[model samples]
Target: MKIAIIGAGGVGGYFGAKLVKAGHDVHFIARGEHLKAIQNNGLVVKSILGDFRVANLRATEKITEIDQPDLIILGVKAWQIKEIREDIRKVLHKDTVILPLQNGVLAADELSEKIDKRNVLGGLCRIISKIESPGVIHHIGVTPTIVFGELDKSITERISGIDRIFKSAGIESTISEDIEADVWRKFILICVSGLLAVSETTYGELRETKETRQLMIGLLNEIFLLSKKAGVKIESDFVGKAVAFIDTFPPSSTSSLTRDVWDQKPSEIEYQNGSVVKMGEKHGIETPINKFVYSCILPRELKARGLR
Candidate 1:
C-alpha cells in the first residue's frame, strides 16, 4: 500500500518505520531537524519489541511532493489537525483513508468537517513513545496497538486491509465495534491523568495526596457526565474504571501533556481538558472540575507558545 505519514513525530516515526520495514511504500512528511536527520541517516526505531532502522527512508517537508496515498496516518498534535487539513487533502486520492492517532475525542469529527467523511476513520493508539533524538523514535511503554473503525462502525474491506497491514508489520491492531465510545474512553483516561499531572507534577503526587486524588475523581466524573449528556454511551461507572487504571500506573509517571509542559512545549490542553469544558457548555451540562483544570492550564500553555 502507498501510505503517507503527515506528522512524523514520535507516533508517526515509530509506526512509519514499522510499515517501511514491512516493505510498504511509506512517505513521511516532517519538518526541521527531524526531517533532515531522517533524510540523512534514515529513521531509527529503538523499541522494546526490538530495535530496527530504516535506511531507505522516503521523507520530505513539502506535502505537494508526496504521491496520492492509499492511507494517511495523522500523527500530528490534536491542535494541528485543522491547520494541515487542506495540505493533506492535496495528497489524497478519491479512496484515501485518513486515520488520526492523536490524543483527543474529536479528531475524526474535526477531520470530517474539513475533509470528506468517507475518507475519515475514527482511530486511537495505545503506546508511549517519543523522539529520543532527531531521527530516533523510542517506544517506552505498552506494545503499540492501533484501534480504528469507520465512524459508523461497519466492517469494510479497507478497514480489513489496514488491519492486515499492521499485523504484517508485527504491530498489534484491532477494529473497535464502537469507535466513538472507545475514543471517549481514551479521552477520559488521558484527560484525567494529564490534568492531574499538570496540576500535581506526577501521578505519584496525585495518588499519594487524598485531596488531589479527590480532585482527580471529580475531573473524571465531570467529564463522564458531559460524555453522557453528549450521548456517547460510555460505561455507567466509567469513573471507577478510570480510577482503577490510574492506580496501576507507576508512581513517577507523568502524562505526555505534563512532560510537554515541563519541557516548555505547546500541548493539547485546549483539546483535552478544554474540550470537556467547551462540550459541556454546548450540551447544557456543568463541568466545573474540567473548567477549573482548563483555566489553570491555559495560561501556562499560552506562555509556552509565547501567546500569553
Candidate 2:
C-alpha cells in the first residue's frame, strides 16, 4: 500500500521507517533538518527492538509531490493541526484514510470537520519516543503500539490492510471497537504523568515523594471523573492500573512534555492538562487538582517562551 506520514517526528519517523524497511511504499512529509536528513540519507530509527536505516526512502516538504496514499498517518503536534489541515488534504485520495496519532482527544473530530468522516480514523499511540536529534528517532519503551478504528465503528478492507502492514513492520496494531474511548484512556495516562512531571521537578521526585504521589493520583482521578462525565466508558480500575504501571517504570522516567518544557521547546500542555480543565468546566465538574497543575505549569511555559 502507498503510505504517507505527516510530521515525521518521533512517532511518524519510527513507524514510517519501519514500514519502509518492511518493503512498503512509504512517503514522509517533513520539513527542516529532519527532511533534509531523510532525503539525503534515510530515516533513522534507533529503538530497543533494533537500530536500522531506510536508505531508499521518499520524503518531501509539500504534500503535492507525492501520489495519493492509501493511508496517511497524521503525527503532527496538536498546535500544528490548524496550520497543516489543507496541506494534509492535498495528498489524500477519495478512499484514503487519515489516522491521527496525536496526544489529545479532539483531533479526530476536528479532522472530521475538514475531511470526510469516512476518511478519518481515530487513533491512539502508546510509545515512549522522541526526536533525539534532527534525523534520529529514539524509542525508549518496549511496547510500540497503535490502536485505530473507523469513526463509525465499521470494519472495512482498508482498516484490515493497514493493520496487516503495521504488523508486518513489527508494530502491535489493534482495530479498536471504541477508538474514542481508547484515545481518552491514553490522554488520561499522558496528562497525569505530564502535569506531575512538569509541575514537580522530575518523575523520580514525584514518585519518590508521598505527597506528590498522592497528588498525582488525585489529578488522575479528576481526569478520570471528567472522562466518565463526558460519557467515555473507561474501566473502573483504570487509575489503579495506571498507578501500578508508573510504579513499574524506572524512577527516572519522565514524559516528553516535561522534557519539552524543561528544554524551553513548545509543548502540548494546552491540549493535555488544559483540555481536562476546559472539559471539566463545560461539564460543571470541579477539577481542582488538575487546575492546580495547569496553573503551576503556566508560569514555566511563559518563562520558557520569554512571555513572562
Q: Write the per-residue lDDT of candidate 2 for residues 1-308, one digit (tens) a residue.
A: 78999888888998888888888888999899988988888867888888887896789898778788888998888767777877768867899889999998989877876777888899989877888887889887748899999877788888898899999988899999888889988888888656655555566678678888888898889989999999999999999988887766555667778887777777788889888999999999899887877777777777866888
RMSD of each: 1.7, 1.8
Best by lDDT: 1
What tens digits encode model 1's per-residue C-alpha lDDT throughout 201-231? 6777887788888988888888888888888
Estimate candidate 2's RMSD in Å. Answer: 1.8
203: Cα error in model 2, Å: 3.0
Q: How accurate locally, in lDDT, is each candidate? A: 0.86, 0.83
Task: Report lDDT (Cα) of residue 190, candidate 2.
Answer: 84
Which run of 10 residues does model 1 get worst, by summed lDDT?
Answer: 192-201
Per-model TM values vs. the true structure: 0.94, 0.94
Per candidate, the number of residue pairs that clash is 0, 0
Where in model 1 is the C-alpha error above 4 Å?
A: none
